[model samples]
Target chain A: QKEVEQDPGPLSVPEGAIVSLNCTYSNSAFQYFMWYRQYSRKGPELLMYTYSSGNKEDGRFTAQVDKSSKYISLFIRDSQPSDSATYLCAMKFNYGQNFVFGPGTRLSVLP
Target chain B: DAGVTQSPTHLIKTRGQQVTLRCSPKSGHDTVSWYQQALGQGPQFIFQYYEEEERQRGNFPDRFSGHQFPNYSSELNVNALLLGDSALYLCASSEYGIHTDTQYFGPGTRLTVL
Candidate 1:
């Protein structure tokens, strides 16, 4: 089994809607979880990160992690057309380890 | 305070060729990490360098290697490149263990192998 799993989605939603993207991992050692946004032909940008099992909110994005189940999520509120991009979930152990990324989910917020 | 910057924004090469991509980390950063992203996949960690040494590496083969200079800049070199090696190479930088949660990435170097 892959260490991380995420649905490859081209999820389409209308503007102003709420969207939720999730990923699950098999490793319990992963302590730091992160979400990244990438546009077409562009590099991935750090969206947000969380070390705890709860939620971390930044502007319109919220990242949630559940270490017990090894599940993580990124929720977007009032999604906009500019929010359309690929969302990647990545995680790592503590320091001194390279991060493992999940297959990203593509999102399109139609205006 | 520029973000991470990579050289030769795009490159095209043939099988059996060798290529080297460079990256300059963000100002004040000291650690550098490399990742590879295929056409439709998420970025995969290649390796990471700290203190001019490789601190960690991923599952990539020996054909892929890297170097980090004293300035915290890095280079990703591929030898005997294969078509499967075509991908976008990304460089990320952070302040060694202090601000790892905020590792920043460059625009990435798009490598094409024919």
Candidate 2:
């Protein structure tokens, strides 16, 4: 099984809708979790990162991690058209040199 | 402050050719990491460089290698390139070492191997 797994979604939602993207990992060693947004043909842009099983909130994005279940989520409130992009979940062990990333989910907030 | 910067922005190469992509880490950053992103997939870690030394590597083959300079810049070199090598090569930089959660990325180098 892959260490990190995420649904490859082409999820479409209307503008202003709340969107939730999730990822699950099998490794319990992961202590740092991150969410990134990628535009078409662009590089991954760091959205937010959390240290462990907790929640971190930004302006419009919220990242939640549940270490017990190895599940993490990114929720977007009042999504906008410009918010359309691919969301990737990444994690790594404490002091681990390399980060493992999920397959990513494509999101389109239509007007 | 300028974020991580990579070049050439785009490249096209034939199979069996070799290519070198460059990256300038974010100002005041000391670590650089490279990743490969293929169509419909997330970025996969290639390797990381710190203090002009190869710090860590991913599952990629030896054909994928890198170097770090004293200035905290980096390069990703692919030898005996295959069509499968066609993808976006990304460079990320961070002030701290591997444990830094604030790693930042460049725009990326898009490579097309024919």
> What's the lDDT for all of these models?
0.91, 0.91
TM-score of chain A of 2: 0.97
Which digits, one per residue and each the tens of the lDDT, describe model 2 over residues A1-111?
A: 988999898999999999999999998988999999999988889999889788999999999999999899999999999999999998888654678889999999999
> DockQ of candidate 1?
0.67
Instruction: Write the residue-wise lDDT of candidate 2 on B14-80 in tens digits.
Output: 9999999999998988889999999998889999888898889998999999999889999999999
Best-fitting candidate, scored by DockQ: 1
Name model 2 segments beyond 4 Å from true. Answer: none
Clashing pairs in 2: none
Clashes of 2: 0
For candidate 2, give the lDDT of residue A68: 94
Cα lDDT tens digits for candidate 1, A7-88: 8989999999999999999989888899999999888899998885999999999999999988999999999999999999
